[model samples]
Target: MFRSMLVAVDGSDIGQKALEQGLAVARAMEIPVHVVHVIQTAAYPALALSDLPPPDIAQQALLDALYREAEEILAGAERTAAAAGVPVTTHKQLGHPGAEIIALARKVGAGLIVVGSHGKGKLGRLFLGSTSSYVVDHATSTVMVVRCEPGAS
Candidate 1:
């Protein structure tokens, strides 16, 4: 008894797999699929510079690049959903990815949220932080975490 499915994608192989799986479920349930890509932005300590450009300018440039990348990722996901004959809507958000995904799921009234895990071990997750873990823990809706195998789609 799901109304809508939301898939959070970040252009990774695992993310694509999650999208595919989410689409399949949505199709079977005859529900709409909404795909979201989040561009994570964080404040960085100012770099010590001798007569260099302003840090704000550098940060803005980096943010621009991230937005462009987010568009490309969303476009690819849109194409995949279209090819599967599944009508889909997409959203691009700027914030912590896990938080943004959960926010969108709630905003869209999604019955399920599908995301991909990078399969990083405990040590790796400790260093890199885990978006899937955050989503699984914080999301109000049901979450499906797709684990990506090495060299497999």
Candidate 2:
């Protein structure tokens, strides 16, 4: 019933679990999986508000590091999916994680969107909004939120 699946990974253990689960579904359904690692560029602007504004060099350095991390995460996802014998595509994006993920799902016309739950608890979610929760709330496609295992960081 699904054409394709979109999996969002953040290099976290829960994110890896989501990837595994998404790949399992993709394999069973015989559909390609689109893996995405989004660099939350929006957060960087907040650094500008510091008493001593971040120099352009510093900002670029942070962005470069984020891009490198994204590359590694997406490459690892590709390798994992390949080993699992599932067709996969990887995307590196810069934006709010939730928005980028949902956008990619829509762009690919994916029937399912898989994301890992931060499992930060109510207070944590209240203070720092959860990306998975945001996607669940906003995405038009089916969403699977893989919860992080207790005591498993």
In order of listing, the candidates' clash counts read: 0, 0
User: Model 2, 16-47: lDDT tens per residue?
Assistant: 99999999999999998999999886677754
> Please, what are the lDDT tens digits per residue for candidate 1 over residues 25-111?
999999999999987753223332324476587767876787799899999999999999999999998777899999999999998
Q: What is the lDDT of candidate 2?
A: 0.90
TM-scores, all candidates, are: 0.87, 0.91
Model 1 misplaced regions, further than 4 Å = 43-55, 150-153
Local error of candidate 1 at residue 99 (angstroms): 0.8
After superposition, which runs of candidate 2 have C-alpha atoms over 4 Å from their true positions?
46-55
Candidate lDDT (C-alpha), each: 0.88, 0.90
